[model samples]
Target: MTAPIVTRDEPVAGTPMLDARLVVDRGAFRLDLALRISAGEVVALLGPNGAGKTTALRTLAGLTPLHDGYVTLDGQDLDRPDLSRWTATERRPIGVVFQDYLLFPHLTALDNVAFGPRRHGLDRQRARAVASDWLGRMGLAEHARRKPRQLSGGQAQRVALARALAVNPALLLLDEPLAALDARTRLDTRAQLQRHLAAHPGATLLVTHDPLDALVLADRLVIVEQGRVVQEGDAATITAQPRTDYVARLVGLNLHRGRADGHTVRVNADFSLTSGDRHDGEVFVAYPPSAVALYPRRPDGSPRNVWPATITGIQRHGDNLRVQLGGPIDVVADITPAAAAHLHLGAGQPLWAAVKATETRVYPAAPGGSHPE
Candidate 1:
């Protein structure tokens, strides 16, 4: 489903500080996206690889030219092909933090953070003072003398963020800001990033593939696929009602779309499942992997949603086993280790998968209309 894009002429109150509809064309691929971020808000751009997330970010940062459409920040047009208006990257009041941190290898942390303010016309002493304050805020004051090579990954990330913020940018762009950190460091840095983002007065755009980062750091989410927006909303709303398989998987739900007749949804010619919620017309049925129960034998319980399937794969998911099954329907089921042992779960083993009708959530499939191919 495509999310609605608020137009510039729309009489909406509290217009977003960052408003843009980016359209860039390559030989075989095109990027068309509408994005808006209010002041003091963090919006996460999430999508699969090659979904044009980077293209959109680059276009907004003036690193890439817009094929059409416009990029407007705080009522000022940054890029407008139709109006022949464009702002150079260095001239725009924007800061960018690359995935690699992109710190100057030879410069000390203090000088690295001081670079942006200096480029923005600050004197050497004034820029260093601002950079020092930012480093202190990031809890990296003591590491100011260390070069990029001497700093830890998390410390380098903080230094990069300090540099980005030192210029007092009007818009901040972060591309996979924490993707390079280890799991433990990522967790700590994510929390720190959330605090810093909350304190920033300008709009911020975060691009990342990790759903956890998006869920934890963003005020809203914009999910794209194949160069078009598929969904956009608050984390809770998107998590509970995913519109596509990609989004469903991101939220850890097994989703299937089909014709809904009362409480039953016909996923395909050979498969139909019952749901607790009732809806007519096209609908999507979703249930978590944990909601599925697996059995070596056909379950002889009430008229529950049950199907015979064969194990396609199995992997450890935390303390549980995640089993992928293939039959009339392909699905993933989470079972305890004890249950896995009891069922002798293995690849190619036949099993029965059952889910309670009440566990399934049903919603209209085309609530927001279709998205681009």
Candidate 2:
């Protein structure tokens, strides 16, 4: 989608593109984070709200100062609080596309893209030339003369991205770059963004809570919660083995931590589950909600993990009904709409939930980590 956006010579891969640690103490909230990104790589900081995903982006861009730790990018020190070394946002070889796009209301898209280069010492004529090429590359040449108010959300977003890349930044930071668009626009823009990012040889950090964005745009995922990293890994690995309830829910899996002895894992004093895989000591178990089956009465045959649960909520999930069950274990169950009707599913209804052992996956939990809530 953005295959032609490389009109200006993009920077070649730089060694040690990003090596940083950031610490921000805000009296009530503190963030201590360390991260690294090589040239031509995209790393996503994924987490729930107030998890400090955007704060990390700001730290790397030098919009927020580090209380401790340092930010070294492409062999340059951007932040080293102890040494009183911190580069201002504009001075750093970084570009940030904020959640809101933040385009100038009165400026034409062309001028908006040219603003950065103009400020960075390029003459008006040359700046406009660069902007013109970028707008054309982004498939926005026709909209180049439109003011921010006249342009569509996706068009404005393209202009914002062009402006950021005009200076050939060594580090690219994006904060929910697609949040303002509609679902359709988001899908299209996301694909366009992926192409642009792939063309960028610099290190890219994307801050978002959307799992799809991280899965599609980033080469690696770093999940943060309460201002600390809970897990960091590739999409497939992290998706298969989430470390926290938040991560599990984000990835659409039911996960529980417990003590494992053989194929059985005790989730709590009141509940236990058997897994196809065996483990010892602390362990984690996960299963897809679709694997859960609801019965009006206790089943009479077949090996099953059965428990009594009260329906706390019910909603449509695509073609299935999502049943929120609360009992010894809190978990979501997906059932065909016809099955839900056959069982007369309703909030507060009593039902038996079962999952086959073969559907459950077991893995070792962090050695000393506490169980996730």
**Top lDDT: which candidate number?**
1
Taking all chains together, the TM-score of candidate 2 against the true structure is 0.94
**Candidate 2 residue lDDT tens string, 300-346:** 78746899999999888999988999999999999998898799988
The C-alpha TM-scores of every prediction are 0.94, 0.94
**Model 2 misplacement above 4 A:** 1-15, 367-373
Q: How much lDDT does candidate 1 score?
A: 0.90
Record all residue pairs in model 2 with backbone atoms less than 3 Å apart, i.e. clashing: none
Each model's C-alpha lDDT? 0.90, 0.88
Residues 319-361 of candidate 1: C-alpha lDDT, one tens digit per residue: 9998999999888999999998899877898888999999999
Residue 202 in model 1: lDDT? 84
